[model samples]
Target: MDFYLTALLQGLCFAGIAFGIYISMKIFNIPDITTDGSYTLGGVVSGAMLTHNLSGYLILPAVLLAGALAGALTGIIHTKLKINALLAGILVMTALYSVNLTILGRSNLPLLNMPNLFTLITFTTNINQNSLIILTGFVLVFTLLIGYLLKTDFGIAMRATGNSEPMIRALGVNTDRMKITGLALANALTALSGYLIVQLQGFADISMGIGIVIVGLGSVIIAETIINWLRITSVWWSLVLVMAGAVIFQFVLAFTLNIGIDANLLKLVTAVFVLLIVGLPRLTGRQA
Candidate 1:
């Protein structure tokens, strides 16, 4: 029961990345690779701040700000410089590698002793109970906030921009700004997930973000696949699918780990799962 609960909490943590992926892939129609680096960038910044005795409360917003800045820069390069969106994201991701290294001042930062949001919650009594409460709260608040944002006027504009850039531009919506805002918000969510993950796992390694974008993409793909089964077309339904997908993914991973599988094979398993999700539609003779 404890193990299952722990896996559930971890799944909720990864759901934030799924949300980020949805914003980029579905909302903005942008193939963003910056999430891979920006996630670590968030963790590095927050972990470094915490190591310096900074308040954990401040770390959350700080990580979000850092991610947003990184994403905005990517948007600027794409919009102002007329670079391709895919290339722009890659360039920013590449730059973030160095930036993250500088922030951490080395390869990794350990938060084993430093106070974090999780520690504060568990300070009084049962660690497991506090962890569950905090994780649940984080997931609920984030999902609700994202759901609300997607219903706002600006969110509608963003959806319009993604669905049809020319139409949005014709409507005087400032497509470039919408793209920037969407990317910033998306990456901020990704960074927040990373911040939470490091706190949960006890350390933040520089290489921890490797393949993060793929994992996020896989989560989104799996969510869409499942949502398709329900014939659900609403944006809120999509967000729910994202959460469900993350939980399912984590469950599969836990199952594999529990079966005494080699730890090094986890990445291979992730890759295979992604491939299967991506190929499911083709196998079923349906559009993906």
Candidate 2:
């Protein structure tokens, strides 16, 4: 039971990253590779701050701000320099690799002795219970907050910009600004997920985010396929379905591990899972 609970918590953390990817890829129609770096940046900043005795609450906002800035920089390069969006993302991701290493001043940062949000959960007792409750609360709050944001006027503009940038411009909406805002929000959430992972795992390695984008993309694709089968066309429902899919993916991995799978084989498993999900549409002759 305890192991299952822990796995669920970890899944929720991954779900946040998946949600961020969904926003960038689906909502904004942008292949923002900044997630690869922003995720590590979040871990580096949060872990370094915690090592310096910073409050966990303060670190949370700092991580989010760092991610948003990284994303906005990518957007600026794409919009102002007229670079391809994919190329802009690659540029920002490459720059952030160096920036993250500089931030940590090392190849990795360990948070074993630092105070984190999990430690502050109850402030008094029952550490495991408190941590679980606090994490669950965060997941619910973030999910609802994202749903609400997508229903707002600015959110509608963002959707419009993604669907047709020229049409949005014709409607007097600043498409560039919408693109920047959407990317910022997407990376902010990704960084927040990184912060949570560091808190939960007690360490942040520079290479931890190497293939994170693929993982998030896989979750999004799998979720969309399953949700489409259920006829869930609403954006909010789609988000919920994605979250569920992430949790299920983690559970499947955990099950595989429990069955004596080699630890080093997990990445291979992830890659295979992604390939299967990506090819599902062709296999089924259905549009995804």
Candidate 3:
């Protein structure tokens, strides 16, 4: 039971990345691989600051800034430099590996005795319950915020840029700027996931972000499947489904481990699971 509960908390910690992927891939139609780098960048930033005795709350804005800058760099490389968007994101992600290493000045940084967000406030004597409450609150706040943003005029414009770039451009909208801002916002949220996860895990590793984008992609894909099935049209509900998808994704992985899958094969299992989730719909459509 405790193991499953921990997975639930981890899913909540990953909600931010799910939201980021939803915005970048679903809304902007950009496969921003910068998420891999920015996520670790967030963890390293948080880890570095906490080691200096900084308040967890105060470190968040820095994490956001770092992630946003990384995203904006990818956007600029893609839009202004005429590079492929995918390649641009890859370049930024690769470069971020060095940047993250430099920031942490080591391969791994532990925060066992350091102050963190979880320690800042106590809701229950049980640490896991306290984490559950705080993580749930964070997820709720982000869901509401993203939902409201998507309903606004600016959000519509951002969506339009992705839906039809030429059309939005003809409408006097700067498509490049929109892409940059959208990617920036997406990576900022991704970084927030790192911020939360590092505190939960009590350490930051240089390799932590390796292949992490798959987690967010898996969650978004799950939500997309539900959206297609329900034909969901509401922004709020879509965001909520995305959050639910994150939780469900984690639970599925937890179940796999509980059923005796080798821990070393977990990544392979994750890949196959996501492939099924993504490919099954298409297979069914063909059969129909």
Candidate 4:
């Protein structure tokens, strides 16, 4: 029960990153690996701010701006400089390592003694439940806002930019701006996930975010499967399913760990899980 609860809390925390990746990868078809760096950047920034007695609310905007700037850099490189999108993201991810380390002044920092958002909520002394409620509230608000945005003209244009870039460009849309805006929004959400996660786990390690993109990718893949099965077209329903997918993926990970897998092998397992997630759909289509 404890393991499952932890998984639930972790999943709720991850809901933001899942949404971020959904927008960047699924919506824009851009594999922005800057997620790996921007995630840790958030943790580093939030951890630093909290250690200095900054209000929890104040740290939120700081992390968002940091993540957005990191993402915007990748976007400008890819769009303005005509660099390969993958290369651009990789470059930023690599650079953010030094940036994060500089901000953190070390490889990692602990937040256990610091005042955080979780401690502010007095509803429940039980840490897990309180964290769950806070994360859920944040996720719900973001989901609604993003879902509503997707129904707007700009949102439709963004999707069109993803679905048919050339056609959208011919339609008098500035595809570069759309891509940059989407990446910025996506990274902002990713940073938010990192910010909350550092608080929840009580520490921010430079390595904490390594390969996290796979986790988000797995969640998105799972969400896509469910979306296809249900033929869910409404933006709201899609957001709900994607968030659910993040929870499901975490549950699966917890189950795997509970079955006695070595802790060091978690990344390997995550990779295999992503492979299966990415491969299974094709296998099914081929069988059909």
Estimate, for each residue in 6-27, the C-alpha lDDT of model 3 and write its tens digit: 9999999899899999999999
Q: Candidate 2's residue-wise lDDT over 57-88, tens digit each?
A: 68888998999999899889988899998999
Worst 10 residues of 2 by lDDT: 120-129
1 against 2, candidate with superior TM-score: 1
lDDT of 1 at 182: 89
Instruction: Name the regions of candidate 2 deviating beyond 4 angstroms.
Output: 123-129, 278-288
> Each model's C-alpha lDDT?
0.86, 0.84, 0.93, 0.90
Off by over 4 Å in 4: 275-288
lDDT of 4 by residue, 30-148 (tens): 99999999999989999999999988778999999999999999999999999999999999999999999999998879889888989988578888888878888988998999999
Which run of 10 residues does model 4 get worst, by summed lDDT?
Answer: 279-288
Instruction: Give the candidate order by descending lDDT.
Output: 3, 4, 1, 2
TM-score of 4: 0.95
Give the higher-lDDT candidate: 3 or 4. Answer: 3
lDDT of 1 at 74: 86
Q: lDDT tens string, model 1, 189-261?
A: 9998888899888888899888888668878888988776566778777898898888888877888788888
In candidate 3, how many Å is residue 76 off?
A: 0.7
* Candidate 3 least-lDDT 10 residues: 279-288
- Between candidates 2 and 3, the one scoring higher on TM-score is 3
For lDDT, candidate 1 versus 4, the one ahead is 4
Deviation in Å, model 1, residue 258 alpha carbon: 1.6
Residue 178 displacement (Å), model 4 = 0.5
Steric clash pairs (candidate 3)? none
